[model samples]
Target: MITVDFSRLTVSPGDRILDIGCGSGRHTCAAYRLKGVRVTGADLNPEDLKEARGRLTFHDQLGEHGGGAWNLSAADVTRLPFPDACFDLVVCSEVLEHIPDHDTAMGEIVRVLKPGKPLVVSVPRYLPERICWALSDEYFNANQGHVRIYRKSDLIARLERAGTRFLEHHYAHGIHAPYWWLKCFVGPTRTDSPAVNLYHRLLTWDIMKKPRITRFLDRLLNPVLGKSLVLYLIKRRL
Candidate 1:
């Protein structure tokens, strides 16, 4: 499911977009669908990069990329391989909380993004994430799991210090927050719980069908209960 609202971000033909920590290519592929853009999906995991490449290739086979070019790279967010000021847009979703040196990653994101270009960064919202952490330790203790929980304002300030001007923020996945709370209560790894399974199915249906009722509820509840906090920012020129 897509989190960044494309309508809030401007895109022009020939713009180059980067999706850092682009697991499974969700946001990367979303950017690729824009007309005449060049999108790159970069991740630290070779396996994830492989999967992203496969998805991009599948999109090409289905003629769904809107004539855009795409590539996948195995790259660390803190030490990206691209030249400075290379990307017109950069997306770093659900990634910062996992890095111990997230400041460095933010710096790299600012460095690679063209001056005055936009960057979209997302992470689990503090309240919902705190609830999950309180409910279950395993939820945040897994390998490569989140190491920090950021209050919305703190994250915005941190990014601003890294040379990006915060524009606005939004919350997403309101309905999914309850599902995760339930999962944490039942044990994050417990896939056998019937309640968790049912919730999972409901989420799957919502993502696939996007029924009007769920959509309305999601939007209505997002400001308070959304699972993810997304921020929009623009890199500042030196």
Candidate 2:
């Protein structure tokens, strides 16, 4: 599922877009479908890169608006391989919390982005994430799992320190918070449980069908219990 809103980001044809830490390529796929932009998915995991590559054959399936080239690379966010100021847009969704030296990573993101271009960053919102931490230590301690919980203000302050101009922020995935709470209660790995399985089905259906009921409910609940906090930041011209 994509966290960053393309409309809010205002992606244009021919913009170069990068999705850093692009696990499984959900947002990468979204960026590729934007008409005429060039999209790249970079990740630390080869398997997820493979999944992204394999999924490209289906880009034609994304329809007329799906009109962009896709590139996949394995790279460290703190040490990106691209030349400076090359990308028009960069997405760092659900990634900062996983890095121990996120400040360095954020600096690298600013370096690669064109001056005045926006970087879309997202993390688990404080309250929902705090609940998850309270529910299970295993949740945050797993390998490659989240290492920090971010308050919105703290995250904004961090971006400012990284030399980006703060633009705006929003909450997302309100419907998924309860699903995670249920998982934490049962066991993070207990997908076999009936409740968890049923909720997964609901999420899958919502993704595929986009039925009105759940959409309405999710929009209504987003401000109160949203699972992710999304930030928009612009690189300052040197």
Candidate 3:
């Protein structure tokens, strides 16, 4: 479920981490568990934010999830409520493609991150996403689901224009692409379909159990047919 591997990404204890557009606070939970990070979960969905906060609180009391040290806030990514150079690490996974003013949002992220801090961004890869779009009209038509599709080269070009210097990029979640194509073929919102249901169960198991066989297959398949392309970036200190 994690796109940015914190260990490989150079995240350290005590770093102040920001998760912009943090739906359900998956990143926040992980950050909190990373030794001594000060994690903040920011999102536009008050309902989701509230639910995420409740989940964190429950886990903390249960001696699980983060062990009681993370923050949650509801805010627009374009107009973040943090001061300049406030965060040591920033995560904007699967968010930029949805925003019409992605430049502004990127600027806000850069403004808040300290120099040399890497920002991780993830978006659906062009081919897989385009296939989904071709498979169903409902896939990209939902109001806030996804506003734009991104090709890797085009996305990197965009980041360059937005003032984010891309350092590296990699693909992930290859196993989820075909499942989504199936969903789009059936119906984007219709999760009750037998096919979708089956795939959902498989994905849940893959995420939770991470069976060795499936993980190996996913790794081999990821580069060629990955669903998401994750890019690492650094905000230039000028």
Q: Which candidate comes out best when scored by lDDT?
A: 1
lDDT of 2 by residue, 1-238 (tens): 7789988887788899999999888999888878899999999999989988877656656563366688899999999999999999999999999999999999999889999899999999999999988997778865258989999999889888887899988899999999998888888876589999999999999999999999999899999999999999898887
Predictions: Cα RMSD each:
1.0, 1.4, 1.8
Ordered list by lDDT, greatest first: 1, 2, 3
How many residue pairs clash per model? 0, 0, 0
TM-score (C-alpha) between model 2 and the true structure: 0.96
Instruction: Estimate TM-scores for all models.
Output: 0.98, 0.96, 0.93
Q: Which one is best on TM-score?
A: 1
Model 3 error, position 65 (Å): 5.8
Model 1 agreement with the true structure over 1-238: per-residue lDDT tens digits? 8899988999999999999999999999999999999999999888888899898999999999869799888899999999999999999999999999999999999999999999999999999999999999899975258899999989999999999999999999999999989989989988799999998998899988999999999999899999999999999887
Between candidates 2 and 3, the one scoring higher on TM-score is 2
Instruction: Flag regions of model 2 displaced more than 4 Å.
Output: 61-65
Residue 212 lDDT, candidate 3, scale 0-100: 95
- Against the reference, the lDDT scores of all candidates come to 0.93, 0.89, 0.83
